[model samples]
Target: MISPEDYNRVKDKVITIDVRTKNEFEMLPHFDWAINIEFSEFISNYEHYLRLYNPDNKLIVTVCNAGNRSGQTSQFLKEKGIDALTLQGGIYNYKRKFK
Candidate 1:
């Protein structure tokens, strides 16, 4: 899990994928560069995004409203051979750290 502080330091060095629902995504403050793909959709559509990202070349950072969903998604990505990471505490932690 990557801490918010560490993420900030490497923010430009990683690709952030937000696995929050559309509703939650709309209501929350997140990174402008984050790609919003709901967790449910991620299971089926992730490969497409993976192709677009070429995960092997970039560090993928998964995040959610909290950490649980992103943690699961990160595990799945890892199993698929992508070098991925889950943000510790997710958006909640980011907010706490920044605001």
Candidate 2:
């Protein structure tokens, strides 16, 4: 997992995937460039989402409220050879550090 500081370093060079539900996403603070794919549909529609935003297969940064879901997503993506990484403390810690 990468720290929020590390995330900031590559934010512009990578694709940020928010694995939160649509409603949660709407209610929470988030990055403007992040794509909301939610965890449930991430695996099934990953390619489509990637095609819609980042077809170049850039490094992917997965994030959630507390890192759990994002961690799982990162593992799955890594297994599929997607070169994905999870945000070390997720958005909660990220906010604490950056807010």
Candidate 3:
């Protein structure tokens, strides 16, 4: 998992994927630059995401309201040879620290 501070330090060099549902993602406050890929869809169509956000040249950071789902997503990506990390404590921790 990546801490909020660490993520902020490399925010420009990474791709952040917000794995929340559409409703939650749209209604909640998330990093403006993050790409939303509802967890279920992301898991089902990971190949699409892998092609769009190839981790070969860029780091991928997964985030959810809390850390659970994002952590799972990160693990799944890693199993598929993608370098991915979960936002420590997810967006909640990020907001507590930086928002």
Ranking the candidates on TM-score from highest down gives 2, 3, 1
Off by over 4 Å in 3: none
Give the alpha carbon lDDT tens digit for every residue of 1-99 in model 1: 899999999989888999988888888877788988999899788888887765466898999988999999999989988888999998888989888
**What lDDT score is found at residue 72 in candidate 1?**
97
Q: What is the lDDT of candidate 1?
A: 0.88
**Count of backbone clashes for each model?**
0, 0, 0
Q: Answer with 1 or 3, whichever has the higher lDDT.
A: 3
Candidate 3 shows a clash count of 0
Task: Report, for every candidate in turn, its global Cα lDDT versus the true structure.
Answer: 0.88, 0.90, 0.91
**TM-score for candidate 1, residues paired by index:** 0.91
lDDT, candidate 3, 1-99, per-residue tens: 999999999988998999999898889879888999999899999988778776465889999998999999999999988889999998988999986
- In the predicted model 3, the residue pairs found to clash are none
- What clash count does candidate 1 reach? 0
Error of 2 at 75 (Å): 0.4
Question: lDDT score of model 2?
Answer: 0.90
Q: What is the C-alpha RMSD of each candidate to the true structure, in Å?
A: 1.4, 0.9, 1.3
